[model samples]
Target: MNKAALILALVAAPALAEPDAHALERLVKQDCGSCHGLTLKGGLGPDIRAQALAHYEAAALQAVILDGVPGTPMPPWRPLLTDEEAAWIAEYLLDGDRE
Candidate 1:
């Protein structure tokens, strides 16, 4: 391929850095797996997959992560997780669904 074509291809290529599932899993396991399953199917907590985070807006996801669901085993993580970390977890699950 020509130098110009190679350069264009490199530029147009999709982002190669997809989020890491293992790292996400580790975070979920450490933070959520005690209640939710290690795989995020279910445990003491309700099935997060069934909840379908894809349906939720980023704001809604943030609310749940930060404030936690009421009348459930899910507990508010405001003190435990910074807003940025919570947002990352929410986006990871909503966008990646590594489980």
Candidate 2:
């Protein structure tokens, strides 16, 4: 492949490397679990179970995941995730599907 093509491929690699279910599950169980509880039942943060999240809109939850709750322990994950990833996480949480 040409140098320019190689460069383009490299640039596109990260965007293509979206997390899979296993990775997402690990993130939730490890990272989010730190605050939300290992089972996401409730911890320092509020419970984020599917039923608990029923009152929240999916978009609103995605916004919270991306931007975080201001003046709270929740920190914005925008830097660490794409909008799609945030939406995925929000949907995952709402679906109550845990690996």
Candidate 3:
């Protein structure tokens, strides 16, 4: 393959690796739970249960996860999480499928 073709192929390739559900779940339960409450009801941060977050679109939730609420104790997670991971977490939270 020519260099240009190789470059294009690489750039066009989708990131095939799905985010680790187990790890993300753990992160949500542990890291997020630390502030959102063990049951994600309410605490120092605020209630993050699915019902409480029904007003939010998944993308908005993902953005909050990636960038955090400025001036709040919520810390940006972009450095530690990929966009895909953040999306997964958003869906997970919205789905209210926590254990």
Candidate 4:
């Protein structure tokens, strides 16, 4: 390939890459954001951005993400999210905690 074509391909490579986190965020917005806000600030569900520190542990968050809490609007996700996906979300919450 020509140098210009190669550079173009490289610049466009990231767009072709599968973004799991972006996909997860889309899913969260679709599934979770009916309650939680788009930014996780708050809605029908408690504010994940503002309150995650007090309400969650990495493990507990993973559990809630994967299996969900009973008797809450939260639904069990055993049929949906894999354990790794749940862990990723928990880590995202921990690392991105707003307060």
Candidate 2, position 64, lDDT: 98
Model 4: residues with Cα > 4 Å off, grouped in runs: 1-19, 97-99
Q: What does the lDDT come to for candidate 3?
A: 0.90
**lDDT (CA) for every model shown?**
0.71, 0.88, 0.90, 0.74
Full-model lDDT, candidate 1: 0.71
Residues 2-94 of candidate 3 have per-residue lDDT tens digits of 999999868865652578898999999899999999899988889999999999999999999999999999999999898999999999889
Per-residue C-alpha lDDT of model 4 across residues 1-99, encoded as one tens digit per residue: 899999997997676454378877678766777888887777988777635655677888888888877898878877877677777777777677432
RMSD after CA superposition, every candidate: 11.0, 4.4, 5.3, 9.2
* lDDT score of residue 46 within candidate 1: 61
**lDDT (Cα, tens digit) per residue for candidate 1, span 6-98:** 998688555423445466558787778778777677788866663555688877887898898889778898876666667777877776534
Which sequence of candidate numbers ranks them by lDDT, best first?
A: 3, 2, 4, 1
Give model 2's TM-score versus the native structure: 0.81
The regions of model 3 sitting more than 4 angstroms off are 1-16
Rank ordering of all candidates by TM-score, starting from the highest: 3, 2, 4, 1
User: What tens-digit string does per-residue lDDT give for candidate 2 at 6-84?
Assistant: 9997998786567576777789889999999999989999999999999989899999999999999999999887787
Model 2 scores worst on lDDT over the 10 consecutive residues at: 15-24
Candidate 1 stretches greater than 4 Å from native: 1-25, 97-99
Minimal lDDT window, size 10, model 1: 12-21
Count backbone clashes in candidate 4.
Answer: 0
